[model samples]
Target: MILLRSGAFFPLIVMSLAFASLVLASLVTGAANVSFEDLLLDPEGSSLLLVSRLPRTLAALLAGASLAVAGVIMQMLVRNRFVEPATTGTGECAALGLLATTLLMQNSSILAKMAVSSVTAFAGSAVFLTLAHRLPPTQPLLVPLAGIIYGGVIGALTNFIAYEFDLLQYISVWMNGEFSGVMQGRYELLWASGVLAVGAYLYADRFTIAGFGKETATGLGLNYKSVVVLGLAIVSLITSFTVLTVGIVPFVGLVVPNIIRRFKGDNVRATLPLVALTGGCLVLASDLIGRLINHPYEIPASTVFGIVGTCVFLWLLYARPQRRV
Candidate 1:
């Protein structure tokens, strides 16, 4: 069965509870002294919650879930466990597009910027996939290595452009994933990425079939190229939305889906929700930890996750059982 089986019940409930608790913590965990009593008695407190806490929390959850799902799709399409949007130049290209929009059309709305970013991201992802296709399929590590190089080149170009135009600050903001600036009316665009994650789930079976390679997918009556394009579109849009909204959160996509797949296996339909939930939990918890660690000031969620995700990635690379091809 492609749907979640009975065996998934306990873990699903446990993760759901954990996600709920994190949501509660995120809703209350911020500066400016928000409390339950304030919510009932103080208009200012309620306004702060509406304007800041709620939106930031939602942004974290949405970005985490969508990015994680996008990672799963990328892994399946590319047939490699180590690759993700940040590695494949999707986020970098999105940032590039954002920089171009900011420099050229200073009055552009966020939607306009996001539209441009998505286009660039899609092109970048398509290029990465094309390069991956030409690599030696027998060497699984080559795909991600190539992706890292590709992303680095694009990132360098982005940095150079930002430097030339004195927009390094803008680039810095987009490259570091943080929620300190998130507020109502500013972060709602992430909901579309969440919707795209749902779209991924609806196409889960096809993606799973596509993971088996083009010949296999074609024999299975799946349009392999179309599936790849659809997956890339979802990944690009999610990457663009997250980059434009909360900056680039490294490894949420890479680490979460890989962790979930280790235990849940490669069945996309069965594991997608768990991956999404785990990713949301990881980001929300990181955000909460970032807030508490500094008290008044803040650490970027990306910085916090980069430390933790790096360790996890190394463990997955070395300490774990041998990887699948």
Candidate 2:
């Protein structure tokens, strides 16, 4: 009847086990190796697990699921599978908002900063949507091209301002995706994305319907404009919380949903969980690989995903099979 009918569930079972193993690997790897036995005998290992490892894993899962769903919603709303918060101007606008607050309100709490960033994100995404709406929909490649240029312009402006004000170091920290510094109290805000994912799931059908165009959705008793706005709001919140907590990571949203959609069709209602699960798995795997690649030192998740996701995205664009079973 749906994606579940095609034996997708088996792959999900396999992915779930893989995800569990990765989570364990995250909890176990690091400068201070942790084991289950350490929980009973080694106080230092226990503290490391509790304070750093667990929080880092939670942050990756939350960000992954949040961004994956956010990407699906964006692609559906814009009718382009390549668009995302990073490719659009959402993350840049958020970084700009944080920079503004740093200069203007030195005493602002992180939550307040996130509020400002969300507003900026909404504005930036609105601009991208407007511009995307102007593009020729027949050429899908043009959509992400315009988005990347748009994001680049915004990001460059933010960087220029950062340099002028000597905030480059702080902006640098806010612009890269890394899990090395995530710890208790710091990474908890990432769960906001997880909560929003639940709402995204409930509205999955509406977003999917909207992708078929306004007339189709309207004929089906859907409020197309409202759905778009709601989707953008959800994306804004996810983008804000994610960038505010862990800097910006690219392609999780763009890559994961597209990968799942290839097999599951466009039925987001049936595929949303897989999207979330796969997103979480990819990010967790990236973080784990980053830890091991450089040994006692570390690479950022962005570095790993940048190389890997770019290759996968290219393959999807070019080498993707001409036929699907």
Candidate 3:
């Protein structure tokens, strides 16, 4: 009951309501009826709800929370507000790893794909951060822009390789974040993202200090490098898990954490759950809106979120005027 008295309670209540509403809507909006009543009275609806609808809802929630927590860790690690797996070449690198595994082993297990992707993602993130610090740091936008370009190059290379191997169609299926294809057996891997989210909560204070940069962190008796590596590992695992389970969902990471940071002022532990809830809610809302707009045939959650995220990104970038030379 003390939770109800806490400052976080009201926001939690609002977010929980939103989350519940979205879950309910998603449960019922598919090709068949999956209402609560159907769960009790109709075996078919019960089966569908259990195997498909429930799993998809959980996937969205897990993916959203993982990515958002990852975004928070990343921004703190690099001290850059705008970087995310999609922008920072992490997703592209993971995709590249996926393609490589497909070509090399052809029938590799999902775990193999995840392992390769996580390795490549760690390397990619390392390169981005190294390059980011090497460049003149006059402009804050420099790092994100570079990361976007790098990710684009990686993406283009991935596409070329896919085209050569006649794997473009398969690659396309995994490039975008879409929940339409989610079913129980396929989505259980996303549970790893939930575990990673909890880990983020545990390391929240360390990341908070690391964001102050090496000198300050070292001064405070912290091993900055270890903290960053742990953070990167978390991000990599989260990214690879999502890609393997539901393809790459962009912007949930980039947008949700930034909004929370702006309003809550970077108290990650306190805001961690909020970031997770808001991110999941945003993706859930996107999925719901897509379901309603097209009815039986639905748009990908990625497409809807892409639009929403792009708008929020623009606002964050240019909402306030900047003085240029």
Please report the candidate that would top lDDT against the real structure. 1
Tell me each candidate's TM-score.
Answer: 0.95, 0.96, 0.95
For model 2, residues 1-325, the per-residue Cα lDDT tens digits are: 5767867578798899998999888888887656767854798878888888899999999898899999999999889988888899888998999999998999999888999999999989989999998999799889899999999999999999999999998888778988888999998888888999999999988998999988999999999889989999999999989999998989988999889888778899999999999999898899889999979889999888878899989988886654675
List the RMSD of every prediction in angstroms.
2.7, 2.0, 3.2
TM-score of 1: 0.95
Q: Which candidate, 2 or 3, has the higher lDDT?
A: 2
Ten-residue region with minimum lDDT total, candidate 1:
1-10
Name the 10 consecutive residues with the lowest summed lDDT in model 2. 32-41
Error at 269, model 3, angstroms = 1.1
